[model samples]
Target chain A: MMLANKQVVLKNYVEGYPKESDFELRSSMISSHIPQGSKGLFVKNLYLACDPYMRHKMSHHISNDVPLLASFNPSSVIIGLGVAKVIKSADADFEEGDYIWGMTAWEVYTLILNTNGLFMIKYTDVPLSYYAGILGMPGLAAYIGFNNLCSAKEGDVFYVSYAAGGVGQLVGQFAEMKGCHLVGSASTDEKVHLLKSQLGFDDAFNYKQGNDLARALKRHFLKSIDVYFENVGGNMLDEVLLHMNLCGRIAVSGMISQYNLKKLDGIHNLFCHISKRLRMKGFSEFDFWHKVPEYLEFPIQLIREKKLLFVEHIAEGLAKCCINFCWYLLWAKCWKEDFSSFN
Target chain B: MMLANKQVVLKNYVEGYPKESDFELRSSMISSHIPQGSKGLFVKNLYLACDPYMRHKMSHHISNDVPLLASFNPSSVIIGLGVAKVIKSADADFEEGDYIWGMTAWEVYTLILNTNGLFMIKYTDVPLSYYAGILGMPGLAAYIGFNNLCSAKEGDVFYVSYAAGGVGQLVGQFAEMKGCHLVGSASTDEKVHLLKSQLGFDDAFNYKQGNDLARALKRHFLKSIDVYFENVGGNMLDEVLLHMNLCGRIAVSGMISQYNLKKLDGIHNLFCHISKRLRMKGFSEFDFWHKVPEYLEFPIQLIREKKLLFVEHIAEGLAKCCINFCWYLLWAKCWKEDFSSFN
Candidate 1:
């Protein structure tokens, strides 16, 4: 039997920033049955992640010229993370109707190869779309960044930047689960409420309205902040250093503020990291990918048991894909609460 | 019985930065016999340490307004870290002619009290001045920073900033002794040669002459920087972040570059920490003070066994004390490799 597929392809190489014209929507045909000796699996893509990390992948020069991140090839599909159902499979582990999720494309169907740690979503009681964000890469990032890298102890106070975003939201909740006092800074009032009320953070503030970030942190943290999960940098990171406790741990999860800027800002309070005996480590989820199987189980159980709550600002269809993607990206960058009125 | 004595004291509080006018030398009287019920001893100071950490004591503004370390009060004898020989004592553990090293005054003769963890210099066959540095606080800082904080493994590539300074010089050698490759960045060609030739580092360079720090690091360490002992911050730190290995560990010992500056330079490459899963930790020797008893014996033994080497830049005479102290404070702020040229 033959199956139909819709594909999204990159039209050309992006230079400084990505525009809507860089992507093109097209159609293709696929065979539904598995072919012998083929490791590739045909997946029906379900939920696609609109992540800030994707922003780094959108540009070629910054990604290619700098040896820091993987470069995206021109004229190829803009690859990203997605939750997909395995509709046709030739891989030994996956089969027809087997619900799995990993790094799929921004298309309706993708032929996935090299399935090293692409986990099958066995736990179906919760939202499968979570495989794209909270229960997937972002969740692993949060766990490893907070629990492992920082060595978060009970009663440790945490200040998370972008606390309402994909990884930030989960990190806040994970901090709560560890019996830590958490204060998050989001871009919107709704995110502030979501962090404090829905997510059970000790306190939260809108970084958009706060004139002085150091004062904002000091206001909520009273004594000192034990751990700082830095997702957004620029002045926010500089301010957090002043209030960090002696021997404080800062897990560098992301720095979205400086990602798009042509010239990056330098932090003034970095010297405080030495004086206070603070630890600031940068980490990514790629290293902790081995822990995904057991790691994914925790978030899935939390969602099913009603212990962990998550909010997804999802876009509906293919026509609104680029606009929805931009909306989430911008919201994630600035204060989401400020833009809630438009939503 | 009255005895002749000598002491050093601060004339007044240093305002902006320390100058020669801040201290005064005085001659007083002391008893040869230990005081009754004092469990105290009389000692002659031999060598003292002029450390950058003492600069924090010069002003009331440093240490978050706490008087943890303040320069000697006006009209009172000045105190510092010194190696002293016991002349007379009543304490059961200490006796006459016993050589000991600890936090002491900048004077010829002194009465010792509150001897907490003060031990006899068991291995003193080498220069007694070694006890003030490689066998004391600086040595312990190097050991703990490399061993405990960094979890430094064999074959790991190491980098130390302020590599000619007391602690950094030892850490570079220690890395070599541990079968790891070492590179050090110092202020002068002399220090770079000293690091490579004397201290047993694989390679070394003058960070002062390096135009692009990131390029310099890439040129030296083509592989990866496994551990970074950060004694100098600002641009050096930014470059190190860009070239750090996956799961790299950074020991935050000091940041001399931005010490006096009210506003510090920015680090643009911090986002790599997250992507690379790097570990950056800040520490002080004071936090691990409890382990001094266990720590003291190792470095003392290392120096005695000829496994460890150290150098000290001492200025003679009490008259030159203020000028000498300023030299150390300035050295801490900038790259000073020509200690011999100061005379």
Candidate 2:
């Protein structure tokens, strides 16, 4: 069967903060039917994750030898993590109507040539959209960043930056459940409320309130942070460095604040490392790939019991992909009730 | 017997760059004889070590809970590591004229009340002043930071900042001896020449030439650094961060650039850690206390063989102590013939 695919394409390599104009939504034709004996799976894309990390891929930024995270080759579809349904498959491992998640483009349909990176969905009990977030790469990162890397102990003073967002919410709740005194920062009052009231954080603050970040950190966490999960780099990281306790661990999951800039902001006051004896480490889901099976059971069970909470913002339609993505780069999420609904 | 002892005392807590007036020279008197049955050792200070780490201890820099590295109690003699000879002793472990190295105040005569931190000077074939740099705290730090922490391989592309100073000089020679491709940075042309000619660094640069540090690093190494020995921790460290290779290791030995400042200079390019899979660890000599005996044999033998070279800077009097200490803070040692006379 022949089908029309609506896709998002990169017009040129992004310069600074990406606008909707950088991405072009174009119509293309594809044959939905797989060739006989071809080991390919034809998928109908459902929920595509609008991750801030995708911003790094939009720019051709790096020294000559350093590898790009994701290279957005012009005229090709912009690919990202997505939850999709296998409509037809000539691959023996996949069956029709089976749900799977992997690198799918921001489009209605995808013909996956190689299933090497794809994961077969075994459970249908949870929401399919969750595979794009809490049960997927972000979930694994949240687990490993706190438990394995941070080595967070009970009674540890834990701090999370970008605390009400995708990974931070899960990290706060999980570390809080582990008997930590959790303090987190968000950009808005509503998100702070969600963090403190709904997400099991001990305390939360709106960083945009125009208070000094270091002073606010000192006020909230009296003894300074023992374990810091650093998702937002730049000034947030700079302030966190000041309050980090001796021998403190910083698990660097993302630098969303630094990623979109033309000239990345400088982190002054790194001198704290000498006196405080801080350990700052950058990590990704690739580091924790082995722990997925072991890490999955606890969060999935907690969610089932309604003991674990998560705030998800979903955008419908592939055409809205560019518009929804622009929000992350601008970092202007108002965190209104409509933007994030907790379950 | 009464003996006159001259000592250098901290006049007041230093504000920014320490001055000669920050330390006052005063005559003190003590019994030249040891007290009967009292556990004390009376020593004549020989070569006192001048190190950059002392800058942190001069002021009240830490929070209440955090431990002070060393507090410079006002009107008291400034204390640091020194090579001394015992003139008298009441302890059964020592007799008259036994050489030792440990913490001794800036004075010609010191009565050591406790010898817990002292190490017996076993061999004296080398210069007695050798204990000040190549065989003391600086040497131990250089050994452990690279061997124990960095796990530096033979062919690794190694970079050292503040490369002509105490620890960096030793680290460069040892790593070069290990057959690593080494590049180093110093603050003067003479120091850069010494790094290339005397210390055996493959290439070296004077950072004070005001070239863009990141570009200079790229030109020298050709590839991103695999191991970074960070002694200077301002913009140079920030620049090194940009050119670090994947799975790069940075041994945070000292931030000499940060210590004396009321506000540490900003490290702007710390954003490079995320993509490079960098591991930056801050360490000190205390971390390698156990490795001293096992590690000492290697470098001491190299020194004996004349294969390992180290530069020594000597300040003659307790009065010259304050003046010489300023060079490390200003980072202005010309590294000319007078600064290092070792062949």
Candidate 3:
């Protein structure tokens, strides 16, 4: 069967901040059935996550050499992590109606050439859209960065930048659950309030208020920060280095602030890493895909017990993809494009 | 008995590059005996090590909050790692005629008030000066950084900056002995030659020659660097980040280049840490002092086997301390003050 596949395509390589004009909505015809004898899954996109890392792929000169982060070709479909339902499958592991989440294109339907990166969504009890956020890449990123990398302990002073972002929110909760004195920085006072009130963070601050981020961090952390979940890189990272306690650990999840700029901001305080004996590591959720089964248990348990809270703004339809993504880039609340209507 | 103690004292808090004018040689009288009933060792200085970290202590505004890195007070004798002969001791662990190495003042005679940091030198077979370079703090630093931190294995591509210095030389040898493909960078062509010829590095380059360090690194590292032992921070670190392989490790032993600068060179490539899944750790030998015994065994064994080579330029008398220290800061060959004549 032939289907009209609506895709959000890259207009051209993005420079500086991405505007809606950088992306174009294009509809193309595609076969709904998987090719005979080929190991491909013809899937219907349900929810597509708008993430900061996606901005890197949009850039003409992507800095990273990682194959997983290959830059997007001009006028091609933007691919991202999303929840989809398998319409037809040539692979033995999946069949029609199987809900799965992994790397998928921003379109109504996708013929997945590689099935290895995709995973069958087991627990449908949680919101299917959550598979794109807290239950998917963002959730796993928080798990790998906070739980695996930070080595966080009770009473440790934990700080997270962009704390109201998808992964940062979860990290703050995880730190709080571990009995840490959690402090988070958000771009707006509203998000900061939500982080402290709704997410149970010990303290939260609007980072945009202060010109001196180091002094801001100092005021929040009376003792000093032991663990820092770095999301907003550049100047934020430089300032955090100054307030880190001895032997502090910083898990660099994403540098959202630097992804758009032609020149990444210089981090001058790396000397602190030596003097403070700090360990700063950069990682992606892609690296920990093998641990999906191992990681799913805790967040799933928390969601079921009503212990974990997720805040997300859902944009309806593929047409809203570009504008919502632009909003997300401006540090809007965590957003996901709802394509469930196409199903 | 009273003894005339000749000393090298800091004249003032240093700015920019340290000079002989920043230090003064003074002679003072001190009792040759340990303070009565106190746990002290009256040591006759044998050899004093001049290290890059000493430059930080000389700065008027020291950046690190580490207690072990407290800035040197103006008009006070500079304290550093040195080998000495105990002439009188009230401490039970040490006695007259015992040779030891630890934190000692730069003087002909040092009455060590705190004996806790001192360690009794066991092997007298090697030159006593080896205790200041090869078998002392630099040796332990290389051990902790390379063996303990890098998780280096055979065939791994390893690179070390300041490869002919006290610590970098040992790290290069360690990488070579591990059967890794080792490359190193030094400031001078002479030091680069010493690294390849005397130090057994697979490839060595003079980082000072080419303005394009990234190109220089790429030329040396065909397969990219898996382990980077960082000594020269600043732009070298920024360049090396671009050439790192997947899952690379960087052990930040010291940032010699930034020690004297009022504003550290901005590191613009830290984002590579995420793309490469790199682990960059900053550490000091002070943190692992408890493991000194364990660390000493490996380097001492290597020295005994005649497999390890150490290059040191020794200056006789405490009067030469300031000049030698200034030379050492200029990336001159590792220098030690020989105070044995005072015994």
| RMSD values, in order shown | 3.6, 2.8, 3.7
Off by over 4 Å in 2: A33-38, A62-68, A287-298, A337-340, B31-38, B59-71, B287-291, B337-343
Question: Residue B214 deviation, candidate 1, in Å?
Answer: 3.9
lDDT by residue for model 3 (B6-77), tens: 999999988888888999999899897766778998999999998889999898654546877878888999
Q: Each candidate's DockQ score against the native complex?
A: 0.58, 0.59, 0.82
Candidate 2 structure quality by residue, lDDT tens digits, B1-343: 7799999888888889888778788997977776666788999999898888788788775554444475678899989999999998878787789998878888999988887777778768888888888888888889888786676888999999988888999999878878899999987787888889888999999886766765677678787788999898887888788888888888888888777778777776765676776777777676556776776677777889998877888867778887777665776543454456543
lDDT of 2 at B39: 83
**TM-score winner, 1 or 3:** 3
Fraction of native contacts under 8 Å reproduced by each candidate: 0.81, 0.56, 0.89
Predicted structure 2, TM vs. truth: 0.92
Error of 1 at A176 (Å): 1.8
On lDDT, the stronger of 1 and 3 is 3
A187-206: candidate 3 lDDT, tens digit per residue:
76777778877899999997
Name the 10 consecutive residues with the lowest summed lDDT in model 2 chain A.
Answer: A334-343
Put the candidates in lDDT order, highest first.
Answer: 3, 2, 1
Whose DockQ is higher: candidate 2's or candidate 3's?
A: 3
